[model samples]
Target chain A: MKKKLIVKKNFLMSLFAVILGLIAGAILMFVTGSNPIEGFYYLFRGGLMNIERIGNSLATATPLIFAGLSVAFAFKTGLFNIGGAGQMLIGGLCATAVGLTFDWPKPILLTVIIIAAMIGGALWGALPGLLKARFNVHEVVATIMMNWIAYWTVFYLVPLYLKGPFLETESQRIPMAASLKVSWLTSLFSGSYINLGIFLAIIFVAITAFILERTTLGYELKAVGYNRDAAEAAGIGVNRNIVLSMAVAGALAGLGGATFYVGFASNMQIGVLPSQGFDGIAVALLGANSPWGVFAAALFFGLLHTGKGFMNAMTAIPPEIADTIIATIIYFAATSVLIERNWDKLNKFRLALRLRKSKQESLEDDSGGEQ
Target chain B: MVDLIYQLFPYAIAFTVPLLITSLGGLYSERSGVINIGLEGLMLMGMFVGALIISRTESIYPGTAIWIGLLAAMLFGAVFALLHAFACVTLNANQVISGIAINMIAAAVTVYLARLISGSGNIQIIRGLSRQTIPILSDIPILGRLLFTQTYATTWFVLLILVVATFLLYKTRFGLRLRACGEHPHAADSAGVNVYRMRYMAVIISGACAGLGGATFIVTISGEFNGTAAGLGFLALAALIFGQWKPWGILGAAFFFGFASTVANVSQVVPMLAQIPGIYLKTFPYVVTLAALVLSSKYSLAPKAIGEPYDKGKR
Candidate 1:
């Protein structure tokens, strides 16, 4: 019960922190000659005002959810997966290739594309994992280097293999069957391009939450995260856990890629990899590496992104300003020492309050006995 | 072949000078047990700051006073990169995440600040570092033209840094302490070396080096700051890894990468490679980097404790 209360307190503090950050961000905007009220009103309306807007938010959030899960899952297992961008690229291309070349029913086609994406991402991740497991090569270095390799390899191969009607540099579009259908509400905003990939994202989020909280594997992963040496002593295979963590992380990132291509982009067109993977790191961190936290964080980011675009369309502010706000918030968030310092003070205060109350109750009992 | 060499030569030198300068900066930081992933961000900030200062001052030499401004930026980067070091070194925060945070912060903040200063997202051309010709050496027919006819002050500065760093890392006691801290901080600490101080020193040196590299690229090569560092930080990083984290090795690798980069950019002008394949030729540098990375994986001789945080209490 005490542990639950502590967790609740931590959650409330994080909520307060986020609110403070947004307020700070708004003040900065106001000082910069932009009306914070209008800017944010536009941002919120753009994100949630209509069904089409909601669809757009969901579309943006879809890939982020996967990337967040990727980073979060890895964090839970005492590893850091920095190669999400490269893995996503490989997954995107693999899924696109399957989506374009294969001919099958809609369900089978989607399944194949997703599986292919996961496999491609898994292979990208596993190489670094295997290298680390075998050679003690730091996963950070290997994964970062592999990201570069995967990016370039994909960049080089895509133009050679998939150049289509979009002209010289771009890729061919995926087939109709491979594309995801938008919901009825989304269709009401007929011209809007949002799809139903958000449903898949939510489903995955639920599955991940369940696995982490309810499953033995989740317990083992948490154990490894808390203390790898202790987990190893308890008969957990640390190497296996690390590799599996990366593999799962890659698969999630891969699913993100699949959603991006099948639901959003015209093709698997990528001259340079999207910054989605890097953004996912921000998402995961802001969410505090929890499943629900990730969902909320993704939505917040999604709203900010959509609103930034709307602001650019409506006002004089450059869209990049939104990015600045986000970066600042995340930078502050990564200053975990600040959080720890505050928590220490809070704990001390609570301890003192408890001691004072206990003494007063004992004094009352003593007085009653005398009477 | 002569035409291809000629086309590649000028650009090859151009590419190598900036990368060499930057890779050396990375070496300084990594050798100190702090990985400077903010190299790219620092470079971006430097380019903008350097250009703005130069344009405003309107004199290349005095405007070059902006060079000192980079120390401010380096301090910022050191503080910023220290976030990574602290996460890794102190609280045992994942080095990669901390690095990514720096990268994200650097990108966003620099872009925002650039707008505030320039009144636009991009800065215009200013008095860039003009090429200087050596009187006697410039007169030589072929080799002189290739090596001495025209170059930025930074090229010479990079050469000097390489020599000095090599001496510092291998010859000097300070170098020995730095390496010892990186390889085994606890051991270094036991030897009465302040491991934290050494690591901080390494990262600061790296930030300054990276800052200089950023300034050089903006003031000399691009003639303006348009955020065109173009993932050069990563290339420099790749160079650092490919160089086996040694100063001399890094110089050699930077030169090779520079050659590949020049070839990729100018392949259209080189008649022989033009017919071979445009797409393949254009992507040669990244491909080379990828190949080098794969090849290095076969025998990576990285510093023993490259990414691991230093802990005083842990034996």
Candidate 2:
């Protein structure tokens, strides 16, 4: 019962953060000489106006879901994996390489591509984990360094090995057989960019939920996160769990890369770290680090992302405003500690008011009886 | 080799100055018990404001506009950092998340405004600081040629700030107090130091210095604000760690990174370096930083109470 209440409170906090974010966005719109209500109306309308748009929103959210899951998973171990971008890059590169090199049947090729991405991402994630566990190196710094290394690696490797026939900047387009899109799905969504990635995302979300809630590994990781010294004293191999958690986190992000590169995007672009990596942080924070919460948050963010361009087309507000709103939401989410404090204060104030009102009413009743 | 060294010297210094200053900014915040990963965002704010102000006023005030722009960037950057300060110091929020939020907001808002003003997400200034050789210093020997000749005024300015910062941080009572706040905030508070105020000031100073660093990049190297600092801010963070949070150490570390990056950028054209793959050169500094972290992990000189929120009631 208490756990359920805490979950509800977290949900409310997230909702409050979202509302604050929207208000901040409205203020920005107002400052920029646009009608806030009108801007938001069009933003939501643009996201939900058609089945095609909704599908696009889900497609856009596919990578975000995985990224969010990855971050959330690592956070459970008290590890900050800021190297999501690098991990994604590596994952995407591996998936792209497998897709381009092989001409196997679709199922076999896709499975190989996904596995390759997972392995690549896992290595990238595990390196920082190992460094942190063994050398006491801060994961944040290690991950960031890893990010730049991955960046330069992709910058060099893609152009040299995976370059398309004419373009020097991007990898060769994946063959149709390896793509996650299918004819039936496309037709169902009225030719939207939705693909197998969304279904993959949902499956992973459920799996992540199961692993985190029902598995011993999840308990160990959480135990370490709560108190490293205590967990160590309790015989948990804190170092091993840290490494394993990071590897798992990296695998999740790697799957995201596969879904992104092969499932959503057709080609791997060089010199660009996918922004979804950073957006994953926002999604995790707003989702309260819960798998289902992450799913819901990613979908909302996806809607904002998909709707932004349409809003820009229809209104004076720029597409960047959507990003602004999302960023503001993240900022509020980070500062939710203040809101939690204030919430308690408000509850106390209300109780005090009720108590004072009851005392006055009893005093009045006594005075009337004496009269 | 001599020719190549001479050619690369100025470019290397140009890159190092901004990084050095920014790392120093991070030094202040971290030394005051706050982890400020928002240096990147603060720097972006600096770049954007610098570009926006300079682009607007350069036509009318060609000689002085850049200075004004830089000043505005510092002001805006300091102002923007207040958000981070409020979140981390006042509200006791997660510093890392707050810093990330700062970065995201800076990136999005700057581009949003830039697109509004320029119709593209980039702002360019008409003129940037020119390299000027010091009159007396330039005639001195090889040292003069490499260090004093054809240098940016901002480079000298930043170097001066570095010296002052070193002195202020080491020689002053205020510095000691600030250091105390970071190392042991409860003790500092018991000793009559206002931990929160010191942290707020430190974070604000970090913002201002990081802002100056960003503007320095615009005036000296980039010559435009393109909505990103190209991870220079993160590199500055690495330098801060690499330097072990010391001012002079930061200078050396920043220069090392600067030199490495300059070599990577020019390696293709330099015959001596052409034999090596560019990837190695490009990733050298980051790899080196990771190695440094490993080597130094046994005896980390990090502030004792860094990243912890001060709660007077707890202790």
Tell me the number of clashing residue pairs for each predicted model. Answer: 1, 0
Q: What does the TM-score come to for chain B in model 2?
A: 0.98
Please report the candidate that would top TM-score against the real structure.
Answer: 2
- Spell out the clash pairs found in candidate 1: B87-B93
What is the DockQ score of candidate 1, to 2 decimals? 0.36
Model 1: chain B TM-score relative to the native chain B: 0.88
C-alpha lDDT (0 to 100) for residue A20 of candidate 2? 95
Q: For each candidate, what is the lDDT?
A: 0.74, 0.91
- lDDT tens readout by residue for model 1, A97-205: 8887879998899888888989988888887777666665566767777676676666667787887876655678877788765456456665455665678788889
Q: Tens digits of per-residue lDDT for model 1 on B164-222?
A: 98899989999999999878888888899998788777876776677667767776667
In order of appearance, the predictions have TM-scores of 0.88, 0.96
Tell me each candidate's RMSD, in Å, in order.
3.7, 2.5
